[model samples]
Target: MGWLAAGDQYEVALIEGRVAARATSGRAAGRQLKSLPKALRDHPEVDRLRRFAEWLDRHAAACVAQTDLWMVSSLPVPTGLLARVWPDEAWQSALRDLAVVGDDPDEVGFLRDATEAGELRVVNLDGETVRLSPATVTLPHPVLLPDLDDLREFAAELGVVQKVEQIHRATWRKPADLADNATTVTEFSGGTYDSRFALAARATSLGYRVTGGYATCRVRDTGAIVEASVWIGEPYWDDEVTTGGLSWQDLDGRTLPLREVGPVAWSEGMRMAAALHAGRRVEEGKDT
Candidate 1:
């Protein structure tokens, strides 16, 4: 009780800061609204955005606390829309750890090919947690170290990797009923890409004006058209697929083998998005 009383002034100051968080919320909502095209305006998605804006307004200060917990805590996000919709540090970090340990859900699903997976058995070193695993599984450098920078990177890597994993698995889990309007297939490209999605991500990272579209490329002049699909949503627009397996003769000729890329994890997001996308009623507070 005495300790609580001692920190009463600091608590008041924190609550005062929360009351003044309107400016922060306004700026974020402004940035989000400006990015939408005129077509998305008045759409149901827009309503979701507006509600998101309002939630930001209500939780701006709470978000600050959540952010602190996310960054400072060694906890994992596990699964929650609160993180995807309004990502906290913990959610981001979990994904980062996921990517670092090679369980990257986005870039590629777990190469479930192996029964024995190498794990980074983290051990506490002094006051921090350090990953304990063979350095051979990774470079003998920062990954095993206990450092804030490493954790920050780990979280970023996970979010991106999960997106990668999301593509191969998206449609099968649940997808664009409009999947009929758009066809997905593996196509060919001539350009040398270390990683198509990674390459595209770097370009967008530097603030380049870019849009996802099919480009004809060649592997030694084979002249294959590579069609890469991208999705635009909150946070970042992402590349969904890049295929160099088909012929341009197909997209133009309108007859081709098709396969959609996505992750098995999206079954939850899909069931929700599909219900919404398909204009089916979803009861509030319902959990799948």
Candidate 2:
């Protein structure tokens, strides 16, 4: 942004997301000040810049959140949409270095850039930059990535840090030995919290919805929508509560047999249950 006249002696502007001032006259003429001059502290220009910085922070956070939602849902994003938003720094930051799959599901690459013409440039596992013009791409959930470990290793080698968690996201796989009629997993049950409110608060803070007495996460698995829920406590319960068994339900609210749950849904449900369980109040000095 161009420097604006703040006062006769000072000019101020945003520099690297911060308000900075430079002397317009005197001994320090044209030199950037180490700190904003006292006179410009309350200047209109300074206040405007500060407000703009605050807005930028909010925009960046919203971009990250939207990107996270896309990844978590493994939704297919149009190439045109990516091209349109690539010029925005906030959007770019949230998308850069994320693992993306093009039309060919087998081909995985780290997103580097999206062109105005709807082409994507990405770094492949082999460390070569390749251009792809697929109509749509998927920022797949880590649980669905076949080469997750290799991608993680390659990302480390290249110093890639994704603003939206992707390759390094925690994932779980369904065990092959589940009983035929089992409908719930009790592995994360019995986690104690000080109060029902505290348990519900933890679920909300972790991005899960508290519906009825369950902390729930809804996911689209394969072609079906499934909701994984872990019982926390009834809405009016004020006393201490323990997490209940985790289970999956179909769109019609029918309890799904463990064997029928898709891989992605199973993993995401387990992830949610485990996160809530992890927050259970622990005794002081006890190993977490």
Candidate 3:
């Protein structure tokens, strides 16, 4: 699953086939996030950066219910946090293993179960730390147009779905600042500025997911929080196209404004589609 915000509006892409999640330039709404002040953004500004990271980290876990928080780069979160989330013995071990693993129903179920255990403490599986609250989706900037689709028919064919019971179109427009580039965009990848994007994928599988709204699961890889966007059995194609700025969203489960809500809907919509499939599992068993 890949999401890009357009001004206040955001688009979530549920991909399948050769195409993975894609984020084009101007896809997400370029909203100013509650970022750490410049003084604290780096190591030298430890006093300032530490305070901001702490505050942002807290919000990420608290603001979004049942989700995981992540960023485009792992720089924002310090290693001190890694030691705090896991046992010192296991901490280093787990910290070495933070990479996006596509939606493993087992992990989802595990998260569902873990949160029930308590406030859902953070975990370190390697160099990466984990959160079970709101998981963030980051981009260099907003995607004016990213890969999207309306796959009611395709999802139904998968047998995991009963039907595309509903398809809703919600759009919102907001003011945004655009330039040749942004300082916030500290990095760029092979992904293009056009409709094509290099989106987050499962470290272990090709399948992508765009659902499971309450929480996000991210694995840290190469000092970046690698969160998988797509889940198993999602559809990704449609001739229909639209353009807007990239959008921003909290990995948290808080309600985003309609504009910022598009990607979230994509996440919700995919789960609903999968739910359509899960229900079938029940009926089949009842018939037996």
Candidate 3 regions off by >4 Å? 1-76, 83-95, 100-265, 281-288
Q: lDDT tens digits, residues 1-288, model 1?
A: 010111111111112112111111333521222233444345453354456556655565454444333322212332223224323433333333222222231121211111123334321212233433232221111212234354445445444343222222223222345344344322112223334454344435432223443222111111233222222222232533322322212234443222332222122222222322222122468422
> Relative to the unseen true structure, what is the C-alpha lDDT of residue 265 in candidate 2, on a scale of 0 to 100?
92
Location of the lowest summed lDDT over 10 successive residues in candidate 2:
279-288
**Which candidate number has the best lDDT?**
2
Instruction: List TM-scores for all candidates, in order.
Output: 0.21, 0.90, 0.20
Instruction: Point out the higher-scoring one by TM-score: 1 or 2.
Output: 2
- Tens digits of per-residue lDDT, candidate 3, 1-288, equal 233332222222222211112223353333323332343233232333345556555554342221122321222333334334434322232222232222221221011112322222332222223554323212110111122132223223332211111211222223254342321111111111111111212211222333422112333333333232322222232222111122223446332343333333333333322332222212334521
Candidate 1 regions off by >4 Å? 1-12, 20-258, 264-272, 277-288
Query: What is the number of backbone collisions in each predicted candidate, taken in the order shown?
Result: 28, 0, 68
Pick by TM-score: 2 or 3, better one: 2
Point out the higher-scoring one by lDDT: 1 or 3.
1
TM-score of 3: 0.20
| TM-score attained by model 1 | 0.21
Residue pairs in steric clash, candidate 2?
none
